[model samples]
Target: MSIENVKNVAVIGAGSMGHQIAMLSALGGFETVLQDINEKALEKAIDMLEQRMNDWVNKGKLSEEQRRLAFQKLRTTTEIKEAAQDADLVIEAVVEKLDVKREVFKLLDQYAPSHTILASNSSSIVNSKIATVTNRPEKILNMHFFFPPLVMDCVEVVKSEETSDESVQIAMDFCKKIGRTGVLLEKEIYGFIANRLLFALSNEAVYLYENGYADFKDIDLIAKKALGHPMGPFELMDLSGIDVGYYANMELYKETQDPKDRPAKCVEEKVKAGELGRKTGKGWYDYRKEVISR
Candidate 1:
């Protein structure tokens, strides 16, 4: 399959990452489609995207003409089969479950053109499993983008056992076209690349907090001031969520089967208790307004 140019980009899943990828593709001049099973989710995504584009226009980052052009090239649909048929590049970005991903890929594999480049925005699941369901595995590659793809500049391209070098290079070229710095991996490993390093640092931070250590705020301040890090571990985890952090670390442990990579017990307990960070109003810190005597 030749992927010399990806003109039509389809993102399956109207969730956060999927919608963001659609936004970037549309902004990058591709005919973009964002699909989701839930019509309400797709509606919300479109509304949110309009607000963001308006903000960009207000800030002078994008002209009204550019925003109008972007909206023209973008589309949203709930019909998975229809979206896949004409897409030159289909990026599946649903929940990170092997069976779920395979089911979506299997459907796209049957319907999409054989030459269409099949990509995934998966953060945890292995690429090899998703590729095996499709006949043209060489056309399947992992093109993982960071959250807010329009803003973040980093991308990772992974080639699995069945994936071809040409596929990896094509993904690299596409990422550059979308205004990102692309890194290619030789083969599929767990977490691809960025998540592994990020979760490892988070695991240690959780361990520190669990022990007789400083409170979450203090630890965060230390990292921010002393290390000059943009965000502290706890603050970052809160933004990312304890549930997300713990789940990714657990997946890492599953991949390596090593005890060290495992998520901290305290994190497991917190996630189990539904203290899932900022969304829950409590995780590492209490969010209710405290009447402090200043």
Candidate 2:
């Protein structure tokens, strides 16, 4: 299907990335449905989108009328069928697990229109793994958005071996229509492009910290001051969630079975303690005491 023909969009899972993708779809004039198994998460997603729209109005980036229209285009539901029934495009943004993603795609394939393009927002797990469980592998591709989809400009469009060229173009066009720069990958890889570079740096950073070379904060300082990075590895982990990075590393390790690909001891410990970064009020930094207290 062509981008122009895709009038309805379904975003499965209403976590951080899913909600933002749904908001962008609504902003792009598509009738968008945001779906999650948890009603509370869906409610939170709607609240966040409304707050963001209000912020845009306050900043004069969006008119009140435009904001109202965007909300009109957005709908929330807990029912998977209700969300995917007539959707021309379905974006799965569930947790980073291959089995879970495959299950989501299987349901999507059952409910979504036959011509609907199925895309995943997975950062490390490729779409091909999920596509194999569905009947329409040709329609499946990866449309991996950044951490915050509304703010990020670049989206990685990954084509599996079974993904059709037409489906790839439609996915690219959809990204452009939603005001994101689409970087197309002809073949699927473990981390795509950006995540591969990011994980490599983070792995080394964790090694340095564990080996007692320097404190995480000092390392973060060096990355910001010396490398001109906006945030240090620890800071970025706090913002993005230590659990997220840890799971991504585990996914890579499952694929490669390399000892170097294992999750860092620090990451595993933080996750075990439920200190999952800003969302949990703690991670590499303690947020409960002070805002991002390093």
Candidate 3:
């Protein structure tokens, strides 16, 4: 079915990106189900969405009635079958692991209607890797969203070799309907476009810092002042979570087997220490007190 006929969307995760994507789908007038196996996470996602929409109302970005309507469009569930059974589109934003994602798609194929389109919000893992586990590869594609889906306007719609033209078009149309600028990738590749470029830049930034050629603050400053970026590599990593980049790099490394694709030692150390950036209150720079102090 075309995006115009799609009435329900299922977002299969309640973590950082999934909940926001579900919110975006609901706000775009689709019945949205935000699903997770953890009951507490589903509860937290509902609470977070309420606070976020209320904040938007306070900021004049959304009317109180609009917020209420969006809330009405959303439902959270701990059951995967309940979320996917009737959904016209299912977006997986679970753990960034090939095996884990493949398993999710396998279940999605079992639960979702035959016409449902399955998309992944993976930053690195390509859709083809996960599609092989399912019978509906033509309906599987990557709809990669950047961190903080509400603020990021760009959405990468990646089509695998098995993905149908109609599925790609539907994914792009859905992105536009939800207020995001959709860029369709002609082919599927790890990291799509954004993460490939960002990860390469950040990998080098880590290299420079680890080698004592420059401090992270100096690197960030150079990237901001000289490169004309809104946020420097370190700051961006902190916001996106250091573990994210670390895992993405590892995934790429596994596919390419290129030592260069491996996570930088500095990033490895931070993830090992559990200093997962703003989420954890510490990362390349500590966020416990003030981010400005960095």
TM-score for each predicted model, relative to the true structure: 0.89, 0.97, 0.97
How would you order the candidates by lDDT, starting with the best?
3, 2, 1
lDDT of 1 by residue, 85-196 (tens): 9999999988766678899999999989888889988876667878889998888888888865767798888888888777787788878777889898886778877887
Local accuracy of candidate 2 as per-residue lDDT tens digits, 1-294: 578899999999999899999999999899999999999999998987888889889999999998999999999999999999999999999988888898888899999889999999999888888888889999999999997788789999999899999999999998888999999999888899998998988888999999999999999999999999999988888887788888888888888899888998888999999999888988888888774311
Which residue pairs of candidate 3 clash? Answer: none
RMSD of 2: 1.9
Whole-model lDDT values for every prediction: 0.82, 0.90, 0.91
The true-versus-predicted C-alpha distance at residue 168 of model 2, in Å, is 0.9
Of the candidates numbered 1 and 3, which has the greater TM-score value?
Answer: 3
Please write out the lDDT profile of model 3 over residues 104-221, one tens digit for every residue: 8999999999999999999988888999989999999999998899888999999988899999999999998999999999887778798879878888898899999999999999
